[model samples]
Target: MTTASTARRPRGRSPLHGGRFGLLAVLPFIAFMLLFAVYPLTQVVRMALSHVEIQNGAFIWDFGTLANFARMFDDALAMSSAVTTAVFIAATVPLTLVLGTLLAVLVDRSALFGPIARNIALWPAVVAPVVVSLIWLLILSPTVGVLNRVLIDVGLPPQGWLGSEAGAMLSIILVDVWHWTPVVFLLVYTALKGIDDQLLEAARVDGATERQIFWRIVLPLLAPALAAAALIRLVMGVKAFDEMYLLTRGGPGDATTLVSLHIRNVFFDRLELGYGAAFSLAVVLFVIVVLLVSVVVRRTVRQGGAAA
Candidate 1:
């Protein structure tokens, strides 16, 4: 090629990755991750594995071994709280997914009220969790609660909704579902909207039943959204302390104690910051593992989609 023509030609691909502006654009995000995400994670790790003590009116962290982990494991309340957290996740994730999906489908399929239904579905999510907890606490209170008042009107005894173990756990789960289901509904509903009406029409034109179209087509399309919403719910589920703490105070016994609640108790109440820090690191590890798995699953799904 002539020198003039060669000079006009580019030698590399577009500057999507290597341009100066590209680096500048990404610098803030990188800084944010380092400052907010990485730094906090490192701090948690350091605190967890250190011997933190008050010396000369100052908190001192001496780098040490994993004694805090051992201490956490040995604490009966800590182990129970971890198990309770798992149980809470196991209970809420499925309930939120099922209920959210059903609501999304009902609203999406509605010819007239779909928009209104979708908006209504998001109302619960807009309400703050703290506010929701307070509301539920009043509702579930044994005496003078509207629910109990109604029961008394019907001659049935007013039950202690948050007083007993079974009732406390069940009440927390229900409250969690009520508060978080709207989030799943919004996500799944958005996913449903991405689906083409032409596909559903084609299925119907081929004499496919409503059940067949939904099961074979709609649900499969919604799988990614469902998985995402479920993971997010599980993450939030581990933080289920706000509702349970407000409603039950983790009490009548340790009946409603969650891992976060236990962590708080150890840190603040028991003055065992080292053990709490270790358990907090454990929680961070769990969250990181879950997020990593989510990334892998999403990558696999994208590859499968591209292959198909």
Candidate 2:
């Protein structure tokens, strides 16, 4: 009787916990991440800290010191590339915020054009980065470009848009702004739409101006969304490569030479794999600094709004 009752006892464990097939089903995804993401990251860290040397026609890896990083610091062009990258980030992020938030405000206020304008705004975001770069290159070309033609017709100089140093950097930043404004517009507009209508109504009852309501209530609520957008832009800025490569090729005498291109030049052009890895790690460190700054700024803005 005791054995029969024990055999009939209810089992509380789910199939996922007890079944081999459940764990097996997710094993492939785990393996995929390990193979692609974890393995590459491990290799990068390993390469970043070591010194590679060729002896007797065989490659030898010595992993103990930061000699590669010391070389990276001594390199002047690498430092300049870091500065150029910083400038690019500073220019693009704020412009995207202002343009995106303004467009979002307009769309949020309009009933008729809201939906249509919103769809049109996403057109740039949907396009591939490569395609966008190609389109801009054609439009900004020196001799046969439409922009130059327009300028010439209006009796202005046919400037070397991408051939000059200052022009190259400005053009790259402008292109980034054009591509990312829609992204900002969509993000900020969504946040604006999510506001409680009653809050705005209450503000109106208290004799608040539209500008006053926007500065006090609307802006504060939008802080989190704005911060998120800024973070996205910041990361994108760190990873900026294709546009600078495709458009400027890091040319015009280091004018648009971002750190990513600098890394490519080190690894591919110069064939210094160890140094490239160290520089890549430096780029990661720079990204961390940018992230910390963004977080502090966001927290400060939110606190100020709350205090007000």
Candidate 3:
């Protein structure tokens, strides 16, 4: 019996053996982070705490003050940039989510056009942001532009899409929405595909109307994906610079001056490297905090849904 049992025993590697290989695989990633991410982040922190000046073509760092950070409180441009950033986020994130979700549902349900629509929706995301901005710039230009020409042909007055304060902000917000809504659609559509059809069939059998089934079953199932999309767009919105910079250059009159643009201006335009570093650090911290809060909220939501 002992001999039979010994022969029947299956041989397999222990988890520790697999874990060692996993560790070895991750060593390169760890080294890369230390070399790139950690090193640069340390340098940023050092610069943030110092008073940096260029003397004789070399940077002189006086590492003894919090004036850079303190100046943030009194800087009017910084305050304005913060408000602009907030408004940008508020305007873009929700529109992106709602439009994305709606598009995703429409595409998912349309059998004949689903594949075509999916491919077309991904086009904006694949195009470079700078290229997108350039295309929109021509479209929104005041004179000799396609949009203005169209408006004139329609017997409507041509408006300055990017030449007024409200127009610039609205234009940038619309551009951001156009660019990112596709990404959110991709996320929500993928989630929609993963949903089991049996649940819907069962709901239909139970006399649930199409709208009721969607609102009751499909939307709940899509909650996590929606949350994930929102978080991604939130982070992207916070760091948005390229489109606004290319389209309006944070104008007209600082209307589209996001925090990232403000930081860039401080660093390169004003040559206030230390203050920019401090501001950059603060933005990084804010992003981190937002990420943490989003994670907590998502978890709570998931738990609450499960409980319900």
- Give all TM-scores, in the order shown: 0.89, 0.88, 0.93
Candidate 2 residue 242 C-alpha distance from true site, Å: 0.8
The candidate, 2 or 3, that scores higher on TM-score is 3
Worst 10 residues of 3 by lDDT: 8-17
Query: Please, what are the lDDT tens digits per residue for candidate 3 over residues 68-148?
Result: 999999999999999999999999999999999999999999999999999999899989999999999889999967999
Model 2 lDDT tens row, 91-194: 99999999999999998999999999989988998899999999999889997888999999999989999999999999999999999899889899999989
lDDT of each: 0.88, 0.90, 0.93
TM-score between candidate 2 and the true structure = 0.88
- lDDT comparison, 1 vs 3, better candidate: 3
Candidate 1 residue 91 Cα shift, in angstroms, is 1.0
Candidate 1 per-residue lDDT over residues 1-308, each given as its tens digit: 69997788688755565679788998999999999999987888888888887778788878877999888767898889888889989999999999999999999889899988888889889897789988887888897677888899999999998888998889999999999999999999999999999999999999999999999999999998998898899889887777787888888699889998988887888776677789998887889898998899899979998999
lDDT of 1: 0.88
- Candidate 1 — which residues are off by over 4 angstroms? 1-18, 297-308
Q: Which residue pairs clash in candidate 3?
A: none
RMSD of each: 3.5, 3.3, 3.5
